[model samples]
Target chain A: MKCPKVLLLAAGLTIFASVDSVAGDVKVIANASVKADTISAADLKRVFLEEKSSLDGSHVEPLLEKEGRAHEAFLQEYLGMSEDDLQSYYQTLLFTGRGFMPKVLGSDAEVVAYVARTQGAIGYVSSAASAEGVKTLAIGVPSSNAERKLITRVEPDYPDTLKRLNIGGTVRLRVSISAKGNVEDVELLGGNPILGESAAAAVKKWVYAAGRSRTIAEVSILFDGR
Target chain B: MSTSVTDKLRVGAQLYDRNLGQLGQYHPSLDWAVADYRFKSWFGVRGGKVKTTLGLYNDTQDLDFLRTFALLPQSVYPTDLRDATIAHLGGDVYGSLSLKHRLGGLAYTAYAGHRSDSIYGGVAYLAAQYQVYFSSYGGLQYGGDLRWNTPLKGLLIGISRMNEDVTGKAKAINPLNPGAGFVPYSAISKADWADQFYGEYTAGKLRIDSEYRRFVHDEQDQTADIVLVEIYDDVRGWYVSGSYRVTKRLALGYYYSRYSVTSVAGGLLAPYAPHQTDTSLPANHVYDKVISARVDLRRCWNVKVEGHFMNGYEYSSYPNGFYPQVNPQGFKPNTNALVVKTGFNF
Candidate 1:
């Protein structure tokens, strides 16, 4: 069978576009004191948010660009937060004694120079910037729908009594998955409560494609009886 | 001002005016000062005058830029009572712990300290109105707070409890014999404690929060011989609030607050009612409804406006912002307040 020309061209462009964007946008840089040369997006978010202070047995700090294209891309791709929201979050942390403001720099050159000189510092700059005297870290695939491809599924068992009684409908659930791809929790979104519980029990045994961060997915199971 | 002394240690101090000279002109007072050191995720220590973490907003109340409302729920966090419970002199042990199997994480704090009241605060303002001049007001204090960040995406819940051994001295009307206009008096609290529980949920641009708090104080008074005087008080407050980020530049919020108190007094001068020795009148509570709007003028500047509709006034030494002393002419069943605040950060 031959693929359509338009479909082939579209697929090619999609691949090229993804590669281009990922390769040319932002580069994660770290100081000499940092032991890891590759960082998961999950850990990056945690460090930047002040939720975690160390990475791979070494103390670490996050430096941010005040404002720029690289800053915007990093915020959206890894942190999934707006600059405004990030600022408010920092303000809350400072006043609560949980965290203080991290160092912020002006441009890609400034970030590169500072990361190269400051111990335990981790920062990001445009891919075009020179990364002399610093380590570049590769980020894992970002969390998205692609990360939740089902690997193993447990079929829900319908109670014989309900099936005999012709009680049938679709049970909807909101599922929480851990970073390592196992189901962490499940709660009923909509459906019969009894069916929801049975469905949740089965979903808890499901597994997904491993990802760098936690993710929430919606699932539905159907029961039919005549 | 706050700065990190090292990677693991930080120090800071804050100063503020209770009210912008509305209740009365007053000198600035220290809000909090402390040095914090974190050794790990499960153990850390703080020393000096440390801030108290009672509810969702207690420690962050002064940071106006962090919230959508100009005035928080007064029933739970009264502006006038800021000095009495904001912080204590001593130390605290605090940390955050992660649990296995996606159970989420726990953050906790425990502290023991000395309570010190300021004459320039709302407590003194109310005392003056009652003709009770306090020469001293303070004592031992201790508390703890625990919060859980559950596996559920954006939900958090917490509980806090604090106990104080309160002592105070003043010149006031003798409770043993009401005929004697003024005399020296002293108070030693047998039980003074506060308990609070709070929860918050955030989904995208919308946030919802709720908290409930209860305070109890039982005191023994020092007066003329052969006369025994004691005081008992119970106060309760709670509020539920919601806010949304309507756009990049605008936000809106609303909250309902309820405050109430019950009390009994003895030979010492009365702090609330003029003629009654014990009371639980409906006027001892305040129920408030509020609506607010916030606008971000710039990345570092924002303005907040809010309106409050209250049904009653707290009529005791509780020192909630709405004090009976501030309103000598008397209080109506309903009151309204409008607030507008702006901030600039660099």
Candidate 2:
């Protein structure tokens, strides 16, 4: 009986440790000049992804930590991209002259100092770091209606030439869903242009559960020659 | 290369392959070396060799990795006029303005500068007009463009206008006049203007693009002591193109393009038999329908195979000059061409 209690305690502690590791604490911080004290995850994603230059009527600039635990966690949790992928995305933006790379700092102290001095600056850091000069932002979770679920999906056709050549890869797409649950638009985030076309055609026919407003979704489809 | 001198100011330089002189031949040149200052999101100033803002693709044309098609539609982005339309040595003011509601934003650019012409221009002039190649060419050029990004995702509409004053000189022995010594002729000295409108939409894996352009040229000739000639040339072109991404590595595209030119006969040769019979030269029109398949072998490399069904003799470089008269019976109104290209860039 005593042995069983010990095993239960050990298992409970193990579960707790795993949960804490996976839910590592991180905080979004902004300069004093920023008007909003809180931001939604969707808007945070937009700002960090360079989709919007302003948030809640205030011009916003995003900063990045060069490479660290905070950087990795921020990318995985908020941006949903890897370090290499984020770098490539910025390169595309730079080459196209659509956007510029955000400023990157070496540590949480550096990030806080820069954000304190710069107007409209926003960044992220580990919860352990002191955000004395900057304002910590409360990130809001998306509402239930904002979570669109796909109800109908159509598979894309593989081109004969590509099949014969045994070429296969994953295509990533960004889809816009209307309030009525119809797919309003789709954009190729990364992929072969020919395969992107076929994937786009099929995605256009996809139907999603109705939402209260427009929702954006990111999806990946794979094509294997065989 | 670029470095920030201050929080708001930066300087950079770009060196790229210059192929406007001869198609498929690359020459190393500085594309832009500039100092840019941004005071706000809605306004900025850039000086040095700035990319021209004439159309949707001009600024990004050199970046192959950013484009969907291996070649932009050739009717508007003609290989022969690439250098003339790409950029200028000067300054530009650019900015963006947000619209009300979820209507998106408006982006605008205004620029001015002098542009150095290329051998391609001279070759095109000689081939089309008088089989006399110009050795040197240069010009002053200016342009502006405006784009509206609508509330609808991935939809943009734009308009652009440009003006240029060009001059060219060449010395060549006239093959038509065998005994004549080398004659020096001003191949081009004219004022040219162009206007264009374009729209693009991208959704899911589908992309569609369309554009229309018109060009007008006023020319004056003083090579002959006995006569001075004045002429006007009008050209129009448009294209509609669409592409689909079938998978991560393959995309298919199709487009239809049309081009036409009309020249008013008012030069020293106006009294010639046909010039007198027709006030305006016969309108030359060309049509091209193309289908292409592109494969992305890697993140930075792509290969494309394209087939073109071409109709009309309007694009025969010497449409009104050498070819029509040299091989009157050999002119083919319809033809086909295959283009295969592999491109890689960083």
Candidate 3:
């Protein structure tokens, strides 16, 4: 009788723990017109992080809820970034003249309202503020602390105007993606004229598996003397 | 004249320009500048400069002080040395001038003048060339030379006379012995001799320059007429050539030439042969053709290897290669030669 009671008590504790985890801290919302029957965790991450710039040739813009428990959880789980790191990344991009951070609204209600008005807007809020105006999405939780994989190569019909004299140098790039994965701006840190355009073009088509549907990424170009 | 290889090496740039390219009895200009330095025990280097002009031509007496008289064989003399043969058949000697400065960030060199022999109305030349560069892991260049620098780039055009003699004071004991006879012309004779080779007025010359993306140069000279062995010999003509880069590493070039010469002498030696003595042949005239290809490959940092081939008519001189001469014999001027060179710049 004693053993049975102990087992029952342990089972009750486990149930309560699972319930707590099931109640998500933040809720992601897309425009009601978003016609996807179901979005994968990877696709949701791509949308919010700016990795995917467009959907069906339509521009995708991401919105952010102002700082709060829900905003912190969303960034940490879906973007795989701490609040401090995300701020620092934006600061770097802004000073370099690459692009700006996504627009932040004061409340979850504001995010929902913006997404409702915009054709391809995306945002996140606390589950408590979830409502009918915005379609809720399940963004993927980050498995590890690493940058999301984006674009790999540019198209073949690009110009061959400049001779690529890789005289041995490094180039750093910071990029921001829209929900549909389009690179809007680019900044070159250190490189000759040859590699700048190619790097930018390829980064624009990057599709992040982590952001699901949103991402911002930084890359380092290494020139190994061949 | 009485030095060994080691002794010559010890004397350095002094002897190299002395015996080399010894033309006829024209006096060659004598000039030399040498400097030696020794800093601490770990470093030592030598610097020197010398320039000499040499060529074969008659002497004129117009410039009495700079005359270049000739030395003929004992059997062909008109009694006195002055009246001997009374022909301009020797080289001129014009002195060479050079300067070298190697210190700090400025290393430079400048050269001017010549050395040759000629008599009566002889020619005098004023020339100079300069270059300055740095000496580090890699070298840097920022100066230009203006003397006898034919054409190494772009389009190559123009006639250049690098051969001239300067009448020297040294005299030889034997006139027939090659090394025994020293230059036999006075300063006037030397100047006259120099003048003959360069002063003899002629519209065409050995020249090279660039045009558009092509490089071209041509050289023509009228030698003496041949008697008996030929019907007509009044030599005169021009050899022209052009080169174009087909690719970054490859190039193609072509050349054409026409030469003519009078086979006979005009004065006393005319009766032996009628057509041979005719001056109507206008000296010399002949036709020629040539083609060439060049290849350049990158080897290392700022280093490149180059190779080229040239084939054409009457384009090769008897002694010197790039200079063209009119041939009396009706022989085709077809030659094939290959060359390889490596270059480095910083």
Q: Which stretches of candidate 2 lie over 4 Å from their true place?
A: A1-226, B18-25, B121-131, B174-180, B187-190, B224-229, B270-283, B315-331
Candidate 1 chain B worst ten-residue window by lDDT = B271-280
Q: Please, what are the lDDT tens digits per residue for candidate 1 over residues A1-226?
A: 1111101101101100011012235768899899875566656777898767776777788999999888998887777788887988887777656678889999999999999999899999965466788977655422234535677866777777777786755565666778798888787755567867877887899887787677766554555533
Restricting to chain A, the TM-score for each candidate equals 0.53, 0.53, 0.47
Best by lDDT: 1
Of the two candidates 1 and 3, the one with more favorable DockQ, higher being better, is 1
DockQ of each: 0.26, 0.11, 0.01
Q: How high is each candidate's TM-score?
A: 0.75, 0.65, 0.23
DockQ order, best first, reads: 1, 2, 3
Least well predicted 10-residue stretch by lDDT in candidate 3 chain B:
B125-134
lDDT of each: 0.75, 0.67, 0.33
Worst 10 residues of 3 chain A by lDDT: A11-20
Per-candidate interface C-alpha RMSD? 1.9, 3.6, 35.1
lDDT of 2 at A210: 80
Better of 1 and 2 by DockQ: 1
DockQ score of the complex predicted as candidate 3 = 0.01
Residue A100, candidate 1: Cα error in Å is: 2.2
Q: Write the per-residue lDDT of candidate 2 for residues B1-346, one digit (tens) a residue.
A: 6666664566777775655323325646666777877665567878887778877777776665554576677667765566767778888888776575457678888888887765544244544345456666667888889999887877999999999897766655544363787676564547789999999998867889999998887665444342234556676779999998787788899999877766655655555412212212222666779998989898678888989887765532212222433444665667677888888866
- Candidate 2 C-alpha lDDT tens digits along A102-213: 8999999999999999998999886556677888765543233435666786667777777668654545566677889788988775546787787788789988878677
